[model samples]
Every structure is written in C-alpha cells, then in structure tokens.
Target: MSVVSPRQIAANLAELWSPRVIADVDDSYVKVARVEGTFGWHSHEHEDEMFLVLQGRLRIDMDSGAVELGEGELYVVPKGVRHNPSAAGECLVMLIERKSTLHTGDQVTDKTRSIADQLRPL
Candidate 1:
C-alpha cells in the first residue's frame, strides 16, 4: 500500500496526452493526464466521462463550438455526444471513466490504443 498524490504526479508527468491512474475503485478509475494538443473526436456509447482540471486550461470542442475550462473547474461529457478535447499548453487533469468503458468507443485512433490496464503510476 502507498500514498499517491495527484499533485505530485501532475508536477512530474512528461507525457503530452497520456493518462496515468492514481486511484481506482470497483467501477471507476481516477487518472491523471497531461495534455498539450488536440485529442481525437470521439464518443462513448455506454458511459459518461468527467474531466476535472487541476491546472491550466482544457477545451471541450463540440459541434456548436468549444467551451474552455480553467483550473478547479469540471466538465462532464455525456454518453453518445461527439466531442473533442484540446489543450494549448501543458495541462493537468483527472479523467473518470467507468471500468467497462472504452476510452474512444468503437472508433480506433492511435490514442485509443491506451487501455485501462496500462493506467499505472510511475
């Protein structure tokens, strides 16, 4: 057993768009991610995702336009809504995904190759 700080992981993370799991429960996982560019446009057919900004800004691009969130703000993307996320600079955030959920639904992208099993801490 060990103590994990999301702040600590965020301060040291080097990946641009990868998420590392810091905590998990029976049906959900809390992951820390550092993003600096645009993510693929995708959707989850059976699960909703919540994104909490720890530092910097994250933009959710929808069909209408984009909504920008700053530190300490949160946004939830509902199931089946097509959306994309982007970060202009380095951003620290947490992603909550259901255990049975696929990160990118049925649409396979290079980023979608990341599996829930690989969400380990450094």
Candidate 2:
C-alpha cells in the first residue's frame, strides 16, 4: 500500500468537475476532485455521498437549505436527497462513495464523467 495526498492529487487535476479515483476501500472508491462554479442538482437513489473539503469552501444546496463547508470540513448527502454543489472559487474535495456511484447521480450533464473516465490512473 502507498500513501496518497489529496492536495497533491487535486493539484494534478487539469479539468474542473472531473474526479479521479485514488484508492478503493471495501465497496467504496476514494476520489479527489477540483471544482469551481456549480455542479448540477441531482441525487443518488441508492447511495450516500460523503464530501470532504480539503481546500477552499463548498456549498451544498439542498431542497431544505444550504450547508456550507470549509477546509477540513465534511458533509454527507444521504441517499435520495437532491442537492447541488457550488464553490465561489477553486475548491479541492475528496469523496468517499460506493463503487457504483455516479458523478452526477441521475442527471446526466455535460459535466458528467463516466465511471471509466474516473477510473483512469492518477
């Protein structure tokens, strides 16, 4: 096994909203992404998603309200909860999600990256 740095991995990203798998744990994949602007509103029907802010800040807009997260903060969007994520500036985030999780959930957008794309070597 080898140690991976989220910050370093995020820095290597050349595209926004593209997530790269860094490791696998049990039935989940550990991913890191660099994002700016806003992602589409969507929800995972059968899987919960965990987002950890490694740099900058993230805002998760839900039907109820919005939850803001800063560096080193984390939030879990439960299954079936429609939510959109936005960042005022470049943000680095780590995600822990089921191996079958889709980047854009049920909504396929131009920003959606296929599982094959995400599985590319970092």
Candidate 3:
C-alpha cells in the first residue's frame, strides 16, 4: 500500500503519454495520461468513458462536429456512442473507465484503442 501525489507523478512523467493507474476500486480504475495527436474512433458497448483535461487542449470528434475541451474541462462518451479523441498539442488528462471495459469497444484496428498498461509509482 502507498500514498502518492499527482503533482509529483506528473513531474516524474513529464514527457510521455503513458498512463499510471492511481487507484482502483470496485469497477473503476483511475488513471492519468499525457496525450497528443488523435486517438482512433471507437465506442464502448456498455460503459461510459470519461476524459478530464488537466492541462492543454483536447477535443472529441462527433459525427455532427467537434467538442473542444480545455483545462479543467471534461467530456463523457455515452455507451455505444462512436467518437474520436484528439489533441492538437501535448495535454495532461485523467481518465475513468470501467474496470472491465476494453479501450476500444468494437473497433479492432491496430490503432483503435489504448489500454492503461503501465502503472507508475506515485
């Protein structure tokens, strides 16, 4: 068991998009990621995906258009909704997804999804 600081974790991982699992309880995993570029278009069949921008800009592309998220902004993709996420520049973000949810719902392309694999020490 351990206690960690987000700021310290952020400073330690200042140059990568790798996510560190900060906590896990019940059916939820809390993680932090550094992001840039565009993520693949995908959807969760049974879970909602939450993205919280800790810094920089992030956007979610919907069929209708795009929703831009700034620092402190958050966006949640509803179940079974198709969308693509992008960031013009490097951004810090926190994600909350179901413990059993796949990073990509139905999309199976190589770049279709990202799972939080590395849990950095915080």
For model 3, the local distance difference test gives 0.75
Local error of candidate 1 at 15, Å? Answer: 1.9
Global fold similarity of model 2 (TM-score) = 0.98
**Whole-model lDDT per candidate:** 0.81, 0.96, 0.75
What is the model-wide C-alpha lDDT for candidate 2? 0.96
Stretches of candidate 2 exceeding 4 Å from the true structure: none
Clashes of each: 0, 0, 0
Tens-digit lDDT string for candidate 1 (13-99): 776667777878788877877788898898898899899999999999978777899999999988888889999888888888887
Sum up the clashes in candidate 3: 0
Kindly list the per-residue Cα lDDT of model 2 for residues 1-122, writing each as its tens digit: 99889888997899999999999999999999999999989999999999999999999999999999999999999999999999999999999999999999999999999989999987
Task: Name the Cα RMSD for model 3.
Answer: 2.8
Error of 2 at 117 (Å): 0.5
- How close is every model to the real structure, measured as TM-score? 0.88, 0.98, 0.80
Using TM-score as the measure, which candidate wins? 2
Off by over 4 Å in 3: 1-3, 7-11, 14-17, 109-122
